[model samples]
Target: MKALFIGGTGTISSAITKQLVEQGCELYLLNRGNRNAALPTGVNLIQADINDEAHVAELIENLAFDVVADFIAFEPAQLERDYRLFKDKTKQFMFISSASAYQTPLSDYRITEGTPLSNPYWQYSRNKIACEDYLMKQYREHGFPITIVRPSHTYDERSIPLGVHGGRGSWQVARRMLANKPVIIHGDGTSLWTMTHNSDFAKGFIGLMGNIHAIGESVHITSDESVTWNQIYEIIADALGVKLNAVHVSSEFLAACSKVDYRGGLLGDKANSVVFDNAKLKRLVPEFVATTRLDQGIKQTVAYILAHPEHQTEDKEFDAWCDKVIQALDAAARSITE
Candidate 1:
């Protein structure tokens, strides 16, 4: 089987590519050629930006692929372009979406795929829901073979502290606790979070691809276990052996800062709370299991942070905030347990 992957260098895409290669499927990676990553030996790399539909179409025009895994599709225009470009040549098109697409309010802790999508005007969630709707529409209208995978908080070795695929925000809190810094909690830090390891998510994606029955369906890829923010901070503090000193910031403050016209502020707005349900995914991939526990994932993240002291120094304010929150959380947990 021949498969083409978009955004090959990204953490999730990289894991998918590795697994596809190991499965003996001929692989092709398409990207803008800016990121430097080690590709599996003999895999074809095509340098083209999907934003330029004409160029992307021209590059993949002659190639017939059994599967096209789109990891970086965020805009409806891009999804439309890809469908028009490869609808005939590709047997199946898989889109990588986020669990945030669920339309239910953030307070709704357990969200399933059936939930209504958020408003289309909300940038990040809107874009994903739009893309998913476009794909499903195409599938119904033209019998376009497609699969949608919604992943929640994927983390792995390639994960950076604050970048895409960053482990849960709790990692930053843990780092702050270790350094005897003050951590800031947005709201009460009572929200529940569940995360899937990249490797496990990749396995689920591959499993879906191999199963023909999985076509024309959306699946949630998430961890079996869930942890609350308070629990998460306490776990990190225990791991790092630090005292808790944290400030509880009102959610209004976070909301106000997020309203600022800046990328960082916008990101903060979108990341305050996210929760999902993976029951359908679990039912679909019965054999799939997450190997990395939250404790282990946190330990790995802490080790990486300590080894890369430069990162901490570079983001001193952020680091200090993380420390304070973790410490405060730990102290709070101890009080409750006592």
Candidate 2:
């Protein structure tokens, strides 16, 4: 099959791209030349900015694809642009949506595709909901072949996955752990969350590429393995060969005090416990299953970051904020005792 990926060099997409190439499918990647090194030897490269419609049109004027997946589209306008660009040029179009688009303060802890789509706290999730709405409309009105895949907290070896992280990246959290500094856990640290490795996510995603039954369906591909926030931090600390100094803090307080918009990441999504039902994904892709446990996945990721100096990014501002929050909370506890 001839497949084209709009943003194939990302953590998730990169894994899918590798699997596609290994499967001997004809693959083409559309992106700037920055991530060319990540592509395998057999894949074709279309080095152009996707925003440059004229350039993209000229390049793909006569080309048709069996499947086209867009990993970079976040807004409704971008999805509209994708619809206009590839409406008639592809047999199947996949939109990478977020599982966070599901209703927040969830009425149901066990999430299925049937879970109502709503999230008021995060504009990011709202935008994804809008994009999904647009695509579903297109599918219903125009019989557009579109498949929606929602991934929850998927990570790769390039970075460790964490619920509470600095604006810069996850490196700072790892840095703090290594330095014996206390790292914050958003809630009591017992809230259930699922983390899927990119390789594991790729298995479910690639199976849906040309899948006929998946065209009109919305499915979220995640690991069935649910771990608590405390366990999540513990896994990361264990990987770093350091003891965790966890400071428990309220998610609401963290959101209020954060300089960046933590409302979306904290209150809207990760703060709530979520366990995904991948039965629909399994039914569609009979071979799909997530096998990577958090401990094993996190260990690989931590090793990668520590080995690569370039990945050790620092965020002093966020570090200072964490320290400030910890100190004030401690002082408050002391005052209460007095």
Model 2 steric clash pairs: none
Worst 10 residues of 1 by lDDT: 160-169
Task: Assess each prediction's global lDDT (C-alpha) against the native.
Answer: 0.69, 0.93
User: What's model 2's overall lDDT?
Assistant: 0.93
Tens-digit lDDT track of model 1 for 100-145: 6765354465678777667432477678888998999999999999
* Candidate 2 TM-score over all chains jointly: 0.98
Give the TM-scores of the predictions, in the order they appear: 0.81, 0.98
Candidate 2 residue runs with Cα over 4 Å from true position: none
Model 1 misplacement above 4 A: 106-108, 119-121, 158-175, 258-275, 308-313, 316-338
Winner by TM-score: 2
